[model samples]
Target: MKTILELSMKSVTLAVVLTAGAALAGCSEINGVMNDLQTMTTSNLPEQGIAQPTNKNAVSLKTDLVGLVGWFENSCGFDPVFYTEGTKENQVQKRFDTFQESFMAKQYKTDGSYTAYVKPDYRSKLPANYREAVKNISVVEDSTGVHYYVDFNNATYRGYDLSRLELFYQPESDYVYDTLYFKNANFVDLKSVFKTTRDDLDELRGGEFDAKSRSVMCYLGL
Candidate 1:
């Protein structure tokens, strides 16, 4: 699975950059940009974490999901810092490395691979009109751990409706293990879907920055 960074880098065009620049004018501060990124990614979602829980509460799950989605959409996806005007590449790389190390599970620190915890084609399955396609969310807790069930709208996998996502939350470590469940009992281990390496990030940074690429930086408020 290609990282969001890889996909966005390859697909960003000059026209898109220009349009985004005009649309995002006055979003100069990095914090504001981050907030905009989150809003852009999750604006269409319904209310989440409405169900009761025993171990981890609804608030914790909601916060974690929001943070995870925001990080995935912006920093992992477009990486505005990489395109920030006058910022050195090394500085951006260091920040990216630090963020990844802190956000990801400790296993990734030693294994040298970042687990996305979602299907490789999950984004592709989302309806074009929907920003965050999550239809509804319910949280529950049993003796094992806290569980979050996330339902999707108009999505299917292997001829079966892609109905639910089960997130097993570990309270001690504050990590989530996710699984995608289909209507027919078929499921995918989201943890096994994609693994990103530092080498991949390095290769992304090594790409040639052409005139259009520089224009993106300028348009993103430099």
Candidate 2:
């Protein structure tokens, strides 16, 4: 059960940075880049909370949670774009209700293993064409049936609002599942910083490593 998430761009540290006051216009939509990242990771937060006494009532609680998220943004200097974007909200709600309703309708034992929730649609906030481009992303498997994606634009569409809603039916997937990320991704920020550090590294290709025969390669001809 290997989950191979290929950015197809050779390297996948793509990011879209938006300067303040700049509205996203004429870009690749950079939609769902965040959701794409989340879907690739698994999350444990939902299992940790107080189970809503009644599933029907859970939506209200969940909606409040959403409001709380909004409030936190206003109260703190946090970015709303970071939280709101990305998720299949309606689908998740429908699924959650379905999961609860089925126990009685199907006359089956409650499968504790079953779970339901929505995942953000990373492309939700994007303009229509971009959203279509994102949805066109086909989920494929190799000859070995290991699923992977290919050929997405290497553009980092910033403005964190571009997002997705993820619903977890099973827990074994490779993607992380927290609202933000599996862990504090300092490495992500680090990659952005390192993006500027290229000095001739970019000019060199994989063949350069193949040609290197010694530890002195960098200084051999100097």
Candidate 3:
């Protein structure tokens, strides 16, 4: 439950600033980054008038056990290479090791789902009561188990598509229902910004840059 401002101040502030200063001076992508910082942290504005009713479709318990397990194992694991370049391997590994300890799924529920808790080790980085206030993430699998229905526990900034908002999955089908309404994210703009910055860095460093990072979805045990 850490606030958006706090996360920016603690995690990406310096790095982003330095990158902007070094590569693209006075580019608008910096504004997009700032906009994302502000928008992604807070809850979406409430809907107008009466709230929409939950779907009446029956909840399905039939799950693809193997697919679900495989997804979870992959999602919760983190790789150091994604966090930094070759020179910072040890630093990335240390940080990722700590992240894995807390994020890795530990228990299989009797209800045929997987859950994970935020470990005490992350207490200092997270809100004081996050361990309790933030509930375990529940992963509900589809019939084929190729897809999943997962809860975000009201997370701040859930990646490019705002994937962590309150979402409903039809137990019998792959229908995903998102409660929040947001403008279509300009991923093209975001991607262009990243690529531009990356290209500049590569040119400056004689093409030594490596764009390798692990998928956050896979690291979350999927």
Which candidate ranks first by TM-score, i.e. highest? 1
Q: Residue 150, candidate 1: how far off, in angstroms?
A: 0.8
What tens digits encode model 3's per-residue C-alpha lDDT throughout 51-138? 2222222111111111111211221213323345554444434453443344333356898765433344443443232232233333
Q: Is candidate 1 or candidate 3 better by TM-score?
A: 1
Candidate 1 or 3, higher lDDT?
Answer: 1
Candidate 3 wrong stretches, greater than 4 Å: 1-97, 106-136, 144-161, 165-184, 193-222
> How accurate locally is residue 17 in candidate 1, as Cα lDDT from 0 to 100?
55
Candidate 2: where is the Cα deviation over 4 Å? 1-81, 84-129, 132-135, 141-150, 153-190, 193-222
**Cα lDDT of model 1 by residue, 6-74, tens digit:** 124334354355556555563355447557656654543324432222232111111123222222223
Per-residue error for 114 in candidate 1, Å, reads: 28
Ranking by lDDT: 1, 3, 2
How high is the CA lDDT of each candidate model? 0.38, 0.26, 0.32
Q: Positional deviation of 34 in candidate 3, in angstroms?
A: 30
Off-target runs (Cα >4 Å) in candidate 1 are 1-133, 157-160, 185-222
Report RMSD (Å) for each prediction in the order shown: 22.7, 24.5, 20.8
